[model samples]
Target chain A: MKEKRLISRRRAIFTGLTSAGALLLSGCLKKAPPTYGSILRLGDDLTYLAQRGLLSQRALVMEYQQTDITSFPVTDIGDPANPASTKAYSKEYEALLKTDFKDWALTIEGAVAKPGKYTLDQLQKLGERTQITRHSCEEGWSAIAEWTGVPLAALLKDAGVLASARYVSFYGFDKYAESIDMLDALHPQTILAHRMNGESIPARNGAPLRLRVETQVGYKSVKYVQRIVVAEQFVDPAQDIQAGWSWYNGI
Target chain B: MSASQTTHSETFRHKGWVKSAHFVITFAFLALLVSGYVILMSHPRLYWGKAGNDLTPALFELPISKNYHHGGWAKAIPFKNLKGSQVSAARTFDIFNENGWGRSTHFLAAWFLIITGLLYLLAGIFSGHFRRDLAPGRGEFSLKMLWRDLVAHFRKQSSAPGKYGLLQKVTYLSVIFFLFPVVILTGFAMSPAIAANYPFLLIIFFGHQSARTIHFFAAVLLLLFLLVHVVMVIRTGFKRNLWAITFGK
Candidate 1:
C-alpha cells in the first residue's frame, strides 16, 4: 500500500513536468521576438508578461523636484560637421547644424493618416511638458535631469495613428535607430525632448530632438531623432536579439 | 525493533519533498553561480550610491581581463586606456561574449531557486519538518551543548550517523531566513521599473549601486556556505550523504 501511494505520487509529478514542458514548447513554437539562450528564455517571457500585466497602462514613474536634478553625464556625441569621420557624419545634419537647427524638421510617417514633417517650432506649438525624471541605464547607472518636450501622445493624435499601428520606430541623425511599443509611445511621459535644464539641448545631448522613454532603460531613449515611423510589427534586422539586449526591457 | 520506534541512525528518513527540494536548489545554485560569474566578469567592479560607470570611480575592482581566444590565462586581452582623467580604460573580455546568455540563465535559475525555496519552506512548516528536524532541541539549547557542537565542527568530529548538529541547524536557518532574502531583495532593487515604481526600495538600499554591492557580497557569502556544506557532506560520509540526498535511500 505504501509502495502504491509512492508510485501514484511519482506519476503526479511526472504529469506536472510533462505539461510544463508542453507549455514552454508551445511558447517557443510561436513567432515571438528572438529569445535568449534556452536556460533563460522561460524566465524572460515570465518577466515581460508579468510587468505588462501588473502595471497600469497609464502608470506614471516617480517624478522628482527640479532641485533634485543631478549631474547628468553626457554620452554618445555625434559630430556631423567633422570631416575626419565622414562615415559617422550626415551632410543633412551638418547643414542644419550650420543654421542652428532652424531648418531641421522631424518627419513622422508610416501607419498614420496624416504623414508630415514637423519643425521644432511646430512641435513646441503642440505644448510642452517638463519632467524631472531619472535616466536609468542598462549598464548600471542613473542620473536625474529635467527634460522639456512635447508629449508624443499629442503628436500621435494630431497625425491620427491608424488602427494597424503597433510599434513606433525612431531614426537618428547619427545612423542609430530604435523602436518602442505603442503602449510606451502613448505614455504621458514619453516625449520628443528638445530642451534640457531650461536651455536648448546641447550637441552632446541630442541637439535637434530626442526621445524620452521614461518607462524603459536609457538606451531606449534614442537621441538626435530625425524621423518617426509607426509600424504594425517590430522588425529588428539590426541584431538587437542576437546581441543580448531584450526588446521589451520595461525594467 | 518495533515499527513505531523511529531509528535516529536511518539516513533515508527524510521525505520525498525534502529530497526533491535539495536537488532543485543544488542545480539552481550551480547554474546561478556560473552565469552570475560570467555576468560579473563583464563589469568586474562594484560601487556605491545611485550611479556608477566607466567614468565614475569604482569602489572595488577585480584583476580579471577579457580575452578573444579560447586559450587560458596567456590569451587574456588588455584594456586600452583613454586620454581622459574622468574615464577608465575600455576593458572587455571576449572569451564567451555571451552576457545575454549569462543574464538569461542567471534569472532563470534564480526563479527556480525562489520557487523551490518557497515550496520547501511551506512544506517544512505545515509538515513539522522544520520543528522536528531543523529546530534546536532542548538539549541542543544548553550552552555546553552549543559549545560542544561548534568545537566538534571545527575539530572535524564526525556527527551521529543521521542527525544534524546544533551548528548545522543555526547555519541552515540563517541561510534560509537571511541570506536568501537579502539576495532576492537586492536583485529587485536593481530593476529600473520596480525601483522607479517603488522609490522606497532606493531609500531602503540607500541606492541601486549600493544594492548591487550588497547583492555581490551576499552571493559570496552563499558561495562560502555552499563550500562548507559540501565539505561537511563529504566529511560525514560521502557515499552515504550522496545517496541519502539523491535517492533518499
Candidate 2:
C-alpha cells in the first residue's frame, strides 16, 4: 500500500512539472503574429529591460590597436542611389555645406544652466580623447576606425546639464535625430568626433562633427550633429521607430 | 488476434522525462528553423570578413533579387523593368518582406530553444538517461558494425526493435554535444554587444561575418539531421514510434 501511494505521488509530481513547463512555453507562443503584419514588439521590450537591468552601466566596449583600423563603410543616407536612402541633406544642411561648414555651430539647450551654440573651433579647444574602436552596424557589418574628439561628458559638464536631465537628444544636419539615456551620455567613450584616422572628418563622413556612441549600434551615433537637447524624459523618434528598428539597439 | 489484445501488446518506451524532452525539442526546433529562415531572407548573402554589404563582395549569394514592389525574393523576384509597366515586368517566385516579424520571432524562439535545451541537458545528465540510452556500448562503436548498419539501410531492412542503431547514436551524440553548442556560441559571437565585450570570439571564429557563416552551416546540418530522423521514424513503425514518444507505452 505504501509503495502504491508513493508511486501515485511521484506521478502527481511528474504531471505537475510537465504542466508547468507547458504553461511557460505556451505563454511565449501565445498570440502568434498573424500574417507577419501583426508582429509582436514585446521581444524588443523584454531585451531592452533585461540588458538595462543586468548589464553594468560602466562597462566599456573593446578598443583595438591603431593598425587594426579598417576602411569604415560610408552609409550616405543622403545618397539617392542607396537602397532605402533618406534625404537627410535638408536645405539648412545644404546652406551649411556650401560654405565648407565654416558658419556651422552645435547648439546645446534644454534642462541646462547655460544654453548656447559653440563653434567647431571652440569645441575643439575642450579636452579630447583618441581611441580605435569597432563600429558594428545593424546591417551585419563592422569596421575598426580611429576617432579623435572632445569627450561628451566633459562638454556636458561644461554646459552644466541639470540633475533633472534624464535623456540627451541629438539633432543632425542630415535631419537624422536620436536620443540616449543619461548613463550613455556620461559614458567615458562617448564623444563628439571631429577627426577620423588622424585627419579632419571628410564631408561625406559627417565632417565638422559626429557623435560616437561606443556602446550602441552605429546608427545611434548621429552624424553631422547640429543640436543637443537635455530632457527629463525620453522622447522616442517616432519615424525611426515606425521604420521597424528597436529604439534601444545596444546589440 | 482481437483489436483490444493487439493494442495491449508489449512495446518499448523511453522514460517520462526523455519523452517529454523529445516532444518539447521537436516543437522548439521547428520554431527555430522557420524563424531563422525568415530572418535569413532579409539578408540572403553571406560574407567572410568583418564587414560586407551590397557593395562589398559576398562569399555566397542566394538566388534572390530586390525591387520597390516587394521587400525581398517574396511575392516575386524582379526580372527586369519593362518600359515602366508593373504588369509588363516578369518576376519569378520569391516571398520576401516581413523582416520585422522575422527578427522579433527569431530572437524569441532562440531564447526558448536555449532555455529548453539547458533544462533537457541538465535532466538528461543528472538522471543517467544519456549514458544508459544514448551512449553506444562496446561492440556498437566498431567500423564493421557501422558498415553493416549502413548496408542494412540501403538494403531496406529495418534493424532490431527497441534499440538505436550505431549511426543514429553517433549522429545524435555529436549533434547534441557539438553542433548545437557551436551554433549557439557562434550566434552570440555575431551580437555586437557580446562581440564588443569579447573580441576573442572574433579571433576564434575568424571574424563576425565568419561566425555568422558558421551559424548558418550549423543550422543546415541540424536540418539534415531532422530530415534523416523523420525518415527513420517513418520507415521503422511510424505509429509505434509515435506512440512510444507520446505516451511512453
Candidate 3:
C-alpha cells in the first residue's frame, strides 16, 4: 500500500510539473502568432547555422581581395564619453585624418610584451587581407561592407598578445565603446579595417580605424578606433550589462 | 451564480467543434505565449524600430529581405542580425532568425487565438461558462462581496457557488473575451506587414508602436488573469475544476 501511494504521489507531482510547464510555454506561444517566429527567425539564422552548422561553410563568410576595397573615412570616435579621451586620442587623431590618415597610427598597449605604435604604412606592410563580411546590427538592420586591413591575429602576433589577456578593449573616435574576448580578438575574420566599399571609408563611417568583428552585433564593432588595450580582465566587468548589451553576442 | 431558471448543477461541456478548437487554440496560443515572449525579451527595451532589431536569433527564425531581391525568384531566408552599418549583414546572434518569421509566427498564432477566441465568445453566450462561471450575481458586485471573496479565498471559507461565483465570471469575462481581443488587436497594430495588408486596422490601432506597447501589456494582463484563474481553481478544488474542464464529472 505504501509503495502504491508513493507511486501515485510521484505521478501527481509529475503531472503538476508538466501542467505548470505547459502553462508557461503556452503563455509564450499565443503571442503575435506562431507564424512570425516561424518565418522571420529562419532567415536571420545564418549565424546560428554557422555556429551550430545548420549547413557548414555554405555559410562561410565571403572573402575579398584587398584591392577591391576603398579606404574608410573617419566620421566618429569609438567612445564619446570614455573618460580616457585625452590618453586615447591626441591631436594625431585629427592630423592623421587631415592627412587622409596616410600618417595615422594604431598603438597596441596594456599587457602586451611588444607594446608598440604602428603607423598606417607599417600596418599595411604587415600584409593586408580583405574579407567580404556581413555586419549585423542589434536594431534589425544589416549591411555588406568589404573591409580591408591587417588581420587581427597578425597584429596580436606582432604585439605578442599576453596569454592572460581575457579581453581586448577598443577605444574608438565614435561615441561607441566596446570590448571583446581574446578569442574573438584573434578570430581569423576579425580585423582593424581602414577601408570600405572600394574607396576610403567615409568620415561618417568610423574611418581611419574600426574593429570588424564578424561574430558580434554592430555596436561592438567600435568605429573610429584610437587605441586597443589587451587586458587579463574586462575594464568594466559589467559594461555590456550596463549597456544592456549581451556579453556573448557570438553569431 | 444564483439559482434561477438555469439549472443549478449544470456542468460545463465542450460545445460544437470546440473540443478541437480548444486543442488547436491551446497549442497555438501556448506557442504564441512562448515564442512571442522570446521576441519580446530580445527588445526588452521597447520602441518602434524594425521588428528584426527587436528579435533574437538562435531560437526564432523570422524571414528577412535584403539587397533588393525582387519577387518571384526573390528567395526568402531566415537570417541573424549581422554586426555592421551595412544594409546586408550576414548574421548576428538574435533570439531568433529573421526573414520576418517571428512576427509572422506571432501574427498567425495571434490570428488563431483571436478567431478561436471569438468563436468561444459566441459560444460562451450559449454554453453559459461566462454566465455560470464568470458573471457575478447582483450581490457579487457589492464591496461586501469583494471583501468576502478575499476573505473566503484566503481563509478558505468562501462557498463554491456550485457552478461559479461572481469572481469566476468577472475574471473569465474579462480575460477570455475582453483581454484576448485587445492583445490580438494590439499585436496587429504593431505589425506593418499586417497593417499594410489590412489598412483598415490602422484606423483601429492608431499606429504600430502604440499597438505594440499596448499589445505587450495586454498579454501581461491576460497572464495575470490566468494566475487568478489557477489560484481560484486550486482554492476551490483542483480535481473538481479539472473534472469540469475535462470530463465535467
> For model 1, what is the error of residue A249's alpha carbon versus the real structure, in angstroms, after optimal superposition?
1.4
TM-score of 2: 0.77
Q: Top TM-score: which candidate number?
A: 1
Which is superior by lDDT, 2 or 3? 2
Count of clashing residue pairs in every prediction: 1, 6, 123
Summed over model 1, clashes come to 1
Looking at model 3, residue B121 earns an lDDT score of: 73
Estimate, for each residue in A37-151, the C-alpha lDDT of model 3 and write its tens digit: 3333332232222232222211234343333222121212222333455434545556666778776678789889999899877777776777775454443333345778888
Taken in order, the candidates have interface RMSDs of 6.8, 10.9, 14.1
The residue-by-residue lDDT of candidate 1 on B32-71, one tens digit each, is 8898787777666687876665445679876554521222
Which regions of candidate 1 are displaced past 4 Å? A1-42, A65-88, B1-9, B66-98, B138-148
**Model 2, chain A: how large is the TM-score?**
0.79
Top-scoring candidate (lDDT): 1
User: What is the fnat of candidate 2?
Assistant: 0.24
- Per-residue alpha-carbon lDDT of candidate 2 for residues B96-164, written as tens digits (9 for 90 to 100): 555555555666667667877898899989998788778988666888888888887777665455667
Looking at model 1, residue B38 earns an lDDT score of 78
Candidate 3, TM-score of its B chain: 0.64
